[model samples]
Target: MAQEKEIHFTGYEKQISNWTDLIPAERFTLLVLQTLTEVSKDPRGTYITNDRLSNIIGLSPTRISSTITKLKKKGYITVQRVGATGRYIKTRDYNHATLYTYH
Candidate 1:
C-alpha cells in the first residue's frame, strides 16, 4: 500500500469554513459545493454549465438547476453565461460556457 501523503489546502480552509456558515441547511448543498471546489482550480473562478455539471456529477439536469439556483440565491457564486444557447451540455442544442465565481 502507498503511504498517505499530506495534502495542502493553502488558504482555502478559512473560506470553506465560512462557506459552511453561508450555505443554509439543505440537502445536496454540500455535494454541489464539493463539485464546484473541484472544478475551480484557481481562486479566480471556472467556467461550467449546469448541463456539464449534471453529466460530471451524474445528477439529472433538473436537480442541477435547483442546486444552482439555491447557490446563486445564497450568494455562494456568481454565474455568467458565455453562450447564446439554451443549454451547455453535450447535446444537439446550442452550447454555452458559464462562468462561476465562488464567494
Candidate 2:
C-alpha cells in the first residue's frame, strides 16, 4: 500500500478552527480545498470541480456546490473563473472547475 503524505498547515489550522459555525460537511470541504491548494503550487489557487470534490468528499455535486456558496457567503473563500478553453479531465470538460482560494 502507498503511504499517504503528511500535510502541515502551519497557521491555517488556527484560522480554520475558529470557524465554529461550520458544520461537519463544510469543515470537511474546507479541509479538502486547503489540501488541494497547498499541493497545487498554483498561486492563483486551486482549480477544482464540484464533481471532483463530490467524489473525494463523498458528497453529491449539488451539495458540494451549495457548500461552496455557503463558504463564499461566510467570507471563508474566494472564487475566480479562469476560462473554459484550457485543461480537461477525461470525459468532462474543465470549464466547470473554478479557481478557489481560502481567506
Candidate 3:
C-alpha cells in the first residue's frame, strides 16, 4: 500500500499568505468559491464535500460552513442537499474585465 503524503500546516499557511496578496480584497472569498467551481467543472461531476473543501483550503469545517453561508447569502453560490449528497453551485459570474487589473 502506498503511504499518503502528509501536508504540513505551515506550508498551507504560507500558501494562503501568498494568495492574500494576489487576490483582491473584494475577491478574498475566491479561494473557496473557485475551488468549488473547479471541482464541479470536472467531467466526472465530482461534488466536493465540506470536509474535503476544508482540507483543501486549510480551514476548519466550521469555517467552511460559515463561508458557505455567507456566499449563499450574497448570492455568490448555492448549495443543494440531494438525498445524501451535498452539491455546491457557484453563481458568481466571472467578469474578466475587472478580475485582477488592480493588483
Q: What are the lDDT figures for the candidates, one per model?
A: 0.49, 0.67, 0.54
State which candidate, 1 or 3, has the greater lDDT. Answer: 3
All candidates' TM-scores? 0.44, 0.66, 0.52
**How would the candidate models be sorted by lDDT, starting from the highest?**
2, 3, 1
Best by TM-score: 2
Kindly report which residue stretches of model 1 are placed more than 4 angstroms away from their true locations once superposed.
Answer: 1-44, 86-103
Q: List the residue pairs that clash in candidate 2.
A: none
Q: Residues 15-41, candidate 2, lDDT per residue (tens digit)?
A: 555568988798778877876765676
* TM-score head-to-head 1 vs 3, winner: 3
TM-score of 1: 0.44
**lDDT tens readout by residue for model 1, 55-85:** 7767777887777676666555555555584
Which stretches in model 2 have alpha-carbon errors above 4 Å?
1-11, 84-103
How close to the true structure is residue 5 of candidate 2, measured as C-alpha lDDT?
62
**lDDT by residue for model 3 over 1-103, one digit each (tens)?**
9998755433222344443433342134455555556556553333667788777777778877777676667555556655666674564544442433321
What TM-score does model 2 achieve against the real structure?
A: 0.66
User: What clash count goes with each model?
Assistant: 0, 0, 0
